[model samples]
Target: MTTAIGNPYLEGNFAPVSDEVSVNDLPVTGTLPPELNGRYLRIGPSPKGSGETGMSHHWFVGQGMVHGVRLRDGHAEWYRNRFVRGDVPEDSPNTNILAHGGRLLALVEGGGAPVSITPDLNRMSTWDADGALRAGFTAHPKTDPATGEMHSLSYLIRPGTEELRYVVMDATGKATHAAELPVSGVPMVHDMAMTATRVVVLDLPVTLSMDAMGRLAAGAPESGDALPMRWNEEHPSRVGVLPRGGTADQIRWFDAPRCYVFHVLNAYDTPDGSIIMDVVRYDTVFRDVFRGPADGPPALARWTIAPDRGTVSEQIMSDYSVEWPRINQAWAGRSHRYGWFGGTGPDSLRLSDDVSRDRGGSFEPGPLVKFDTATGEASAHHFGTGRVTQEPTFVARPGAEAEDDGWILSVVYDGTADRSELVVLDAADLKAAPLARVHLPRRVPFGFHGNWIADNEIGA
Candidate 1:
């Protein structure tokens, strides 16, 4: 059998790291705040060594590795990287790293169960939520700030099943709600939105193509080089709202226009009973993509669902190419004014929405986008040329008064030097200089979501 010469995902900065290192008392530029006491942990896919390199390596598929910075008592304590166990066994946990039920969980939406790890970045065990979360779980699961309940719409692709499960787990590591929802075809449902009374699920145009999968399994050359999923132009786009803690049969489905959302910023319900949500929408996905993301760029869009009127309306907020919308987690499942995102500037790498078989082009991340939903404004913080950043996590100051009273934490990779630094910026003034920079020994490639686990909240 012959193989393609190059795959974009396996080359350049997207390449996997060769080793995991533990460094203590990393150098710091500015002062670390005393109130910021906890671990800033981020997870993403990173295959080990050159053997994992291939033309078929999608950015979304790899072994998951957790890179963390320990913050405690006004000092940057340590930085460590570890491979998550039990999922791919010898591969990547590459998706989202989360803190739930007193354990750190590594999640991937595609078909692997959550791999629980220790607070200090040690491998623990594969969890099924006490036999509650079966099949597999998604990378993004929303937790209710009011009730401490975790909600997930997990999907499993068997031979002849078109059903997915909606499972909810309470604070103490116990599964409380489990129900199955019907779907016509298997879609790559990456993320979901949670409101006070409902969890929003997207059934978009991108669905699994068994024909493509069969070709890959049958040793089709290019099948090993591209994603098996394809865009279904005829598939209707829609959103389903399931009542919090309600069974799958109770889900209310509303028709939506043709689009796709990979991550939701924040969502809430109006007093008039309409659900309002902010998401990063793409015109198409998995249709004519290169590595992992949608072929077209994404925008910050709003979707308003009226249960009484039986209509779902979408409003595009900003056309700036962006994804990975994050707000203060405390404001999740409720209304919030501000959110942060990993956005692209004018010269950033972009994908064409048209179909192309050959590997096309690539670009680095542009700026950290600070979006104000209330004022309809977006400000970008550029990190110089060849320097890219990942999803910015908002860390609220203890005893914070205003919603924007916090610091934004992100791992900024300097492509020139081939090194990474954890940059902290004032949440209120995103354009300002970094408040502090915790330099690391190596680069942490651009990856998925993370959390700032307050020391009081975890046993690290």
Candidate 2:
């Protein structure tokens, strides 16, 4: 049970770790794969102070922290955690970290800019490399596997005015193209999907709070820059499809069902000229996020957007409460059979409590789930007892041939030991025994997305 007055985000396993440490030669269980030669890195919001809870506390807003574990030639070398640096209190950028332009970046949507970080897990600086990202960058920018190009659709919501930007960056990470997209009140477009020929945008019902806007104008104490985005009944939920490297004016808008999507599983074009977009659809958000999560649990669903009809249809793909969907990057912006997400079960909370600093925390990832789109079959690697998993990142073995031929790497919190470990599971057999478990000195509090940066991708 959460403390009567304590913020749910800061009280339990969700609580933030105060110290940043570096430890080499971490303890390992099982055998570390020799082919895994890179760093398993992840980032998320960590509260700068426990006192910043209550009416102002939010899982999405906090000091951006990066946690990383290095692997090379059958050994887990080191683990380091660092807070992304910026201007000061004015610069808390916690969201997702990714590799772009051959450099690693820490990104947060809605106002905080993307900050670059060293491969050794050190914060570099706020990246305006050539000044491509004028506003804010999205946490979920789609990286094209074929050309190594990154595509992003970002929205900035402040005291007044509203709009979205379409940005394209080459493999080296210089902004090649940028365009401004006009829109009504600020709508929460957290993630975007990409196909071989187009950029898929989600324009749902979650709108920025005007009441919060008014409060900010009156100089209310600033807790977070997000400023509370709430669900709007009057707003029409929709999706926008724009041709790749095209302007927003050419976008074809399609009416979508009354729902919200925080992340997309995958999307591609159908043979019949239709587009298949899979996403984690939420019933609502920011409804009561300050008190608790808004929706029960988001589910994986598929929406078929038919442009001729100007409408989108959805089908629930899995009944499981899932989020943070991932797929092989090679299959991204294209079709694939396998998909993965974090799942929860009946005894989820009970298991979470053991590792949690306190009782009564909110939703935490329970298991790593794998899905076969071709067969509609499901597989899971559940953390049996006294453990919880974070977003699983897929890493394909060198010269991998099959779709699920690599390994699923995730940061796991072991309640019994009260420490975190990075577990590696064969993607083809997620339920099988972990290939290896690299132990961490401290816990990796529940966090957002990250990716495995291969040796070649990291600068020397």
What's the TM-score of each model vs. the native? 0.93, 0.93
The backbone clash count of each candidate, in order, is 8, 3
- The lDDT of each candidate is 0.78, 0.78
- Candidate 2 global CA lDDT score: 0.78
Give the candidate number with the greatest lDDT: 2
Q: In model 1, how large is the Cα lDDT of residue 69?
A: 94
- The true-structure Cα RMSD of candidate 2 reads 3.7
Superposing every Cα of model 1 onto the true structure, what RMSD results? 3.3
What lDDT tens digits, residue by residue, belong to model 2 across residues 1-460? 1332445566656777778899999989999889988898888877664434444566787788899999988999999999888755546578888787778888888866888787887647777657778677888889899999899988877645467888999899988888777777788889998999888888888878877666556756333323567778888888889888888689888889788888987899987778999888877765645333434566678899888777789888765666789998999989888997777534332222433222243665688889887877878788678787868899987898899999899988877877889999999998899999998988888888888888788664
